[model samples]
Target: MKQSDIFRDNADNCLQLAERAEGKPAYKRYSRMADAWTALATEQDWLDGEIPPVKVRVLQMQDT
Candidate 1:
């Protein structure tokens, strides 16, 4: 959950960067970050019930 939240936060930032790139060299990198965030989310789902609550707490910090 922590990983997912961090990934989600970073993905949001990367998407913003990608939007600004709009024809620049960094576009691909930002796009890839967004994809990585998706992969993280999928992996978290596959993790089933093993995730730690501390991790989730950490992820929540990203929003603050």
Candidate 2:
């Protein structure tokens, strides 16, 4: 599936979860996640191109 589609799906799932949440905290968490996903999808649609890949570094713990 496309990235945009995935984001939209995630948002829908979040909203559904929010609706079924038992408390304010859980509901808010899901709602926020849905908002985040929706925003990402909107931004992706505006970009209309492939999103750039992010670079990451793996941090290794020092042996004590």
Candidate 3:
């Protein structure tokens, strides 16, 4: 959330850099990514994911 907000605020800076042609190819790539990045910035308030570990229990066997 916070990082994305930071990016939002810096968007103009990105466009300006791209406009200034820091490097033609890199500028085009970054410029293209700007929209996707904007989507990511606007898509969610926070990130969520889950990864769980396995567990096992053992018991002594009784004689038959």
Taking all chains together, the TM-score of candidate 2 against the true structure is: 0.71
Query: Which residue window of length 10 is worst by lDDT in model 1?
Result: 52-61
Q: Write the per-residue lDDT of candidate 2 for residues 1-64, one digit (tens) a residue.
A: 7788899999999999999999999999999999999999978876865655457999999999
As a TM-score, model 3 comes out at: 0.46
Model 2 alpha-carbon miss at residue 63, Å: 69
Q: In model 2, which residue pairs have backbone atoms overlapping below 3 Å?
A: none
lDDT by residue for model 1 over 4-60, one digit each (tens)? 777788888889999999586789989998999877865775575555434443444
lDDT at residue 8 of model 2 (Cα atoms): 100
Please give the lDDT score at residue 5 for candidate 3: 75
Clashes of each: 0, 0, 0
lDDT leader? 2
lDDT-better candidate, 1 vs 2: 2
Relative to the true structure, candidate 1 reaches a TM of 0.58
Model 3: runs farther than 4 Å from truth? 1-3, 45-64
Off by over 4 Å in 2: 49-64
20: Cα error in model 1, Å: 1.1
lDDT of 1: 0.77
Among these predictions, the greatest TM-score belongs to: 2
